[model samples]
Target: MNRKIIITGTTCTGKTTLGKKLAKEFLIKQIDLDDIHFLSNWIEKENTAFVKDVNSEIEKHLEWIVTGSYQTLLKDTVWQEGTLIVWLDYPLNLILRRYFIRTYRRVFLKERCCGENYETLKSTFSSESLFLWIFKTYWHRKRRMHHWKNTLFSHKEWLILKHPKEEQKLRNLLYDN
Candidate 1:
C-alpha cells in the first residue's frame, strides 16, 4: 500500500510488534517513538527537541509505520499526514496484565530500550513505572482515541483491531498483498 501508517495504542498493546511486522511487509521504515523520545537513563527528551527530531525523521521517509502515543509532541503532525491509523483497542484487563508482565520481565532482565535502562524499584515505583502510567492513562487514552476516530481521523482508514485474532487476520491480509 502507498499509505503512511501509524499504529498506536496504550502501553503494552503490541504497537511495536504490529508496526514492525507491517513495516517489513510494506518495505517501509518503522519509527518507534520511544527510541527517539527517550534518552539514556530513561530520561525523556525535551518537548521541543522531541518534536524537531520526530519531524526530521518523518521527513526522511516517503512511507513509514510510526508507532507510539506521543500525543503532546507528535499527535497533530502524525494524524494530519498519516493515511492509515490502526488502533489496538484491547480490553483493560488484557492491557494491564500485559503491561505488568512486560514491566516485570524488563526490570528483572534489565532490558534497555534505545540504551536507556529502567531505574531501580524505588525509582520505578515512585513516579516512573510504566505500569503505573498505564493504569493512570488507560481510560483517558481510550476516550481520546475513540473521539479521534469519530472526529479528526474519521476520513482515514482507521482500523480497530481489538483481539489477537483480528490482528492476525489483518496481518495476513496485508501480507498476502
Candidate 2:
C-alpha cells in the first residue's frame, strides 16, 4: 500500500509517540503539524501560512506519517491524503493522567516546546493552558472524530483504539507482517 499514515487524537493521546514509532519502522518522514503550527512563545502560525507549510512538507514526501489534526484547516490536504487513519480515542481519565505527567515536566521542569515556548505554572492552570484545553475539548473532539469517522471519513480506513490496554493489539495491527 502507498502509506500516508495519519495519527490523530484530541490531546496527549500518544499521537506523536505513535507517529514517531511508525515513521521509524516504515523509514518514512514524520510530519508533526504542531511543529509547523506553532511559532516561538506558543504563538500559532497564521492559518494561511500553516496550511501552506503543511501542504509543502506533505508534498515533499510521498510516504510519511503525520501527527496532529487541524481538520478544519487541513481537511483538503493532509487528511485527504491519509491512507490509514489511526484515532487514539483513549478515555478521559487516561488522557488527564498523561496530561499531568507531561505538564509537570514541561512546567516545573521547564521543558521547551513548540519553538522555545515553556509551560509556566501560570500557563498550566490558566484558561489558555493545554490542561484546560484538554478538558474543554475532550468530549467535543471525541464526538467530532466519531462524527467524521461515520460521516465524512466513512470511506477511509480507520483504526480507532479506545484504551491503553490495546497496545499489543495496536502493535500487532501495525507492526506484524
Candidate 3:
C-alpha cells in the first residue's frame, strides 16, 4: 500500500512500534515526531523550526508513516494529505502497563530514544518525568484524541484498534498486503 499514514495514541500505546512495523512492511520511510521536536539533552525545538523541519522531511517522501501524539504536528499539511489515521485506543490499564514496562526498560537498559536521549533515574523521578506527565495528562490526552477523531479527522479513513488482538490482526493484514 502506498500511503501516508499517521499513528497516534496515548503514551506507550505503541505508536512508534506500529509506525516502525508499518514502515518496514510497506518499505516506506518512517518519521517520529519526537525526534524532530526534542533535541539532545531533552531540549524542545522551537515551534516554527520543529514544524518546518518535520514538514521538510515529510515533503521529501511519497509514502511514509509518522508517529506521535503532538496535535500541533497534526495540523501540518502532511497530516491533512495523509491517507490513513490510526488510533490505538487500548484500555487505560493496558496503556499504563505498557508505559511502566517501557519506562523500566528505558531506564534500566539505558535505551537511547528520540534525539538520542536516555531516560535517567533522576529525570524519571523529576518534575519532567514522562511517567508523571502521563499521570497528569492521561485523561486529557484521551479526551483530546477522541475529539480529534470525532471532529478534525471524521472525514479521514481510520483504523481504531482497541485491543491487542486487533493490533495483531492489523499486523498480520499489513504483512499479507
What C-alpha lDDT do the candidate models reach, one value each?
0.80, 0.84, 0.81
Residue pairs of candidate 3 with colliding backbone atoms: none
CA lDDT, candidate 3, residue 106: 89
| Model 1 global lDDT (CA atoms, 0 to 1) | 0.80
TM-score of model 3 vs. true structure: 0.90
Superposed by TM-score, candidate 2 places the C-alpha of residue 92 at a distance from the truth, in angstroms, of: 0.4
Between prediction 2 and prediction 3, the one with superior lDDT is 2
Superior candidate under TM-score, 1 versus 3: 3
Worst 10 residues of 1 by lDDT: 112-121
Task: List the candidate 1 regions with Cα displacement exceeding 4 Å.
Answer: 172-177
Model 2, span 85-169: residue lDDT tens: 8889888899999999988998888877665678899888787988788888888888888998999888998888888677566
How many steric clashes between backbone atoms does each model show? Answer: 0, 0, 0
Residue 67 CA error for candidate 2 (Å)?
Answer: 0.5
Candidate number of the best lDDT: 2
The residue pairs that clash in candidate 1, if any, are none
Query: What is the Cα-based lDDT of residue 150 in candidate 3?
Result: 89
